[model samples]
Target: MSYTVALFRSILFWIAFFVMSSISSIGGVIALPISHRGTIFFVRIWAQAHRIFCRFLLGQTIVVEGEMPDIPVLYVFKHESAFETVEQPMLFKHPAVFAKEELFSIPVWGQAARFYGLIPVDRDGGGKAMRAMLGAAKAALAAGRPLVLFAEGTRVPHGEAPQLRPGFAGMYRLLGIPVIPVAVNSGLAFPPRRWVKWPGTITYRIGETIPAGLPREEAEARVRVAINALNPPEALLESN
Candidate 1:
C-alpha cells in the first residue's frame, strides 16, 4: 500500500509540475517586458502552487521553524532535495537566488529566472566569474533582496554529508550581510533524484543569525555547525 501510494503521488507530482510549469511559463513571457518584480510575482505563485500540491497529493506539510528576520540577509541553506529549490522563493519575499549558470540556459524557465534576479554561478570561470558573482550579489543586497544560496552548491541525499562549498565563505565575506543558516531535512520527505515523496512534515529549521563582518573562518564554522544541526551525529561528524 505504501509503495502504491508513493507511485500514485509520484505520477501526480509530475502532472502537477507540468500544469504549473505551463502556467508559469506563459506568465513569465507576459511579465518579462514589464519588470523584474512582475516576474517574481509569477514565480512566487508557482511556488505556492507547489506547496499546495505537496500537501494535497504527497501529504507533505512544510513547517518553517524560527523567526525569519524582516531585513535583507544572506540565507545559506542545506540542499537536500528539490523541495527547497522550489519552495524558497515563496518562503522569503523576493529573494535573489544564486543558481548554476547552466540552469539559466533552459528555455522558458531560464527567461523567468533571469527576470527574477537569480545570480548565475560560473564555478569554473576562474576569478572573472568570482568577481561577477560578487558584483551581482552586491547589487542584490543594495536592492534590499535577501540572498539565498545552497551552501553545499548542490543537493545531497538524506544522511550523506558534504562540506559547505568554498564559494559560500567567499560570498559571506563579500556580501557583508547577516548570515542565516537554514537546516532542512526535506530529503527525508522528498529525496533527491527520485520520485518517491514520503508523507511527512518538511521542516525548514532556521538557525541563529550570525552577525555580518565576521572573519571568513568564523562565519563558515558557525554556518557549518548550524546548518548540520538537524543531521545525525555521525553525519555531522562526517561533514566536519
Candidate 2:
C-alpha cells in the first residue's frame, strides 16, 4: 500500500480504537462493581474488536505457530510492538500479564487492568517491588491464571534482540514454573510509535517449553536465544 493510503487506514483504525477503548474502559469499570467476569467480558470484547479492525481496516493478519500450552506457566514473549500487547488477551486464556507499574495508574483503564489481574512491576523498587510482584503472581496462579511477561522489560525495535531483563530470572526462580518463550515479528507490520501500519502477517513463533528449576544463567540463556529466533540473522549478529 502507498504511504498515503496506509496512513489514512492507520488513522481510521486509531479513531476506532480510541472509541472502542473508551467504551470498554467505562464498561469494565462499571462491571467491576457487579462481577469480575463481567469486567473481563468487556476486556475480551475490546481485544476482539481490535483484531477485527486490524483485519478489515488495516489489512493485517496474525498467525501463530506451535501449540499454546493449556496449563498455567510463565509465558515469556519477545517485546517488539504494542501489537502483541493487545493480542495477549485473545491469545491466552485469562493470563495475568506483568506490566509496568505506570500502566496500572492510568485512571479507569488502570483500575480495570488491576481488576483483570495484571501484575505491576516497579523497575526501581528493588526487592520490595519484586516481592510484591511475586505475591501478585502467586495469587494469580492460585486463581488458575497463567503468567504473561515481556521479559525484555520494554519493547525493542523489530529485528533487534536484547538480553532479558534481570527480573525475568528472579520471577522464574521464585515462581518455580516452566517457561514458554514466544517470538513474534509484529513490528514488521505494526511498527512501534508509528502512525502508519502496513498490510502483512504478523507471526508468533512459540519455542519449546523450558522446564522450571534450571540454573538461572542456563535458563536465561535458553530464553534469550528462543525469543530471538525470529529476528533477522544480521540483527542477531549485531546483538552478539
Candidate 3:
C-alpha cells in the first residue's frame, strides 16, 4: 500500500481503537464491582475487536510460529511494539501481564487494568517493589492465570535485542515456574511511537520453555537468546 493509503487506514484504525478502548475500559470498571470475570470478559472483547480492526481495516495478519501452552507459566515476550501489549488477551487465557507502574496510574484505564489483572512494575523500586510484584504474581498464579512479562522492560526498535532486565531473573528464581520465551516481529508492521502502520504479517515465535531454578546467569542467558531468535543476526551480534 502507498504511504498515503496506509496512513489513512492507520488513522481510521486508531479512531476505532480509541472508541473500543474507551467502551471496554468503562465497561470493565463498571463490571469490576460485581464480578472480576466480567472485567476480563470486556478485556477479551476489546482485544478481539482490535484484532478484527487490524485484519479488516489495516490489512495486517498475525501468525504464530509455535504452539501456545495451555498451562500457567511465565511468558517472557520480546518487546517490540504496542501490538503485543494489546494482543495478550487474545493470545493467552486470562493472562496477568506485567506492565510499567506508570500505566497503572492512568485514570479510568488504570482502574480497568488492575481489575483485569495486570501487575505493575516499578523499575527503580528495588526490593520493596520486587516483593510487591511477586505477591501479585503469586496471587495470579494461585488463581490459575498465566503470567506475561516483557523481559526487555520496554519496547525496542525492530531488529534490536537487548539484555533481559533484572526483574525477570528475580521472578524466575522466586516463582519457580517454567518460562516460555516469545519472539515477535510486530515492530515491522506496527512501529512504536508512530501514527502510521503498514500492511504485513506479524510473526510470534514461541521458543522452548526454560525451566525454573537454574542459576540466575544461566536462566537469563537462555531467555536472552530465545527471545531474540526472531531478531536479525546482526542485531543479536550488536547486542552482545
Q: Could you give candidate 1's per-residue lDDT for residues 74-182 as a string of tens digits?
A: 9988899988988877787888889999999988999888878899999999999999989889888888888899988888987766877899888877777789999
Candidates' lDDT values, in order?
A: 0.85, 0.90, 0.91
| Best-to-worst lDDT order | 3, 2, 1
- Candidate 2: regions farther than 4 A off: none
Model 3, 2-74: lDDT tens digits are: 9999999999999999999999999999998899889999999999999999998899999999988756899
**Residue 204 of model 2: what lDDT?**
92
CA-only RMSD, every prediction? 1.3, 0.9, 1.0
Better of 1 and 3 by lDDT: 3
Model 2 pairs whose backbones collide: none
TM-score preference between candidates 1 and 2, better one: 2
Cα lDDT tens digits, model 2, 65-177, are 99877568999999989989987789876889999999988989999999988899999998888889999999988887889999999988888988889899999999999
Q: Runs in model 3 with CA error above 4 Å?
A: none
lDDT of 2: 0.90
Model 1 whole-model lDDT (C-alpha atoms): 0.85
In model 1, the runs with Cα more than 4 Å from the true position are none
TM-score of 2: 0.98
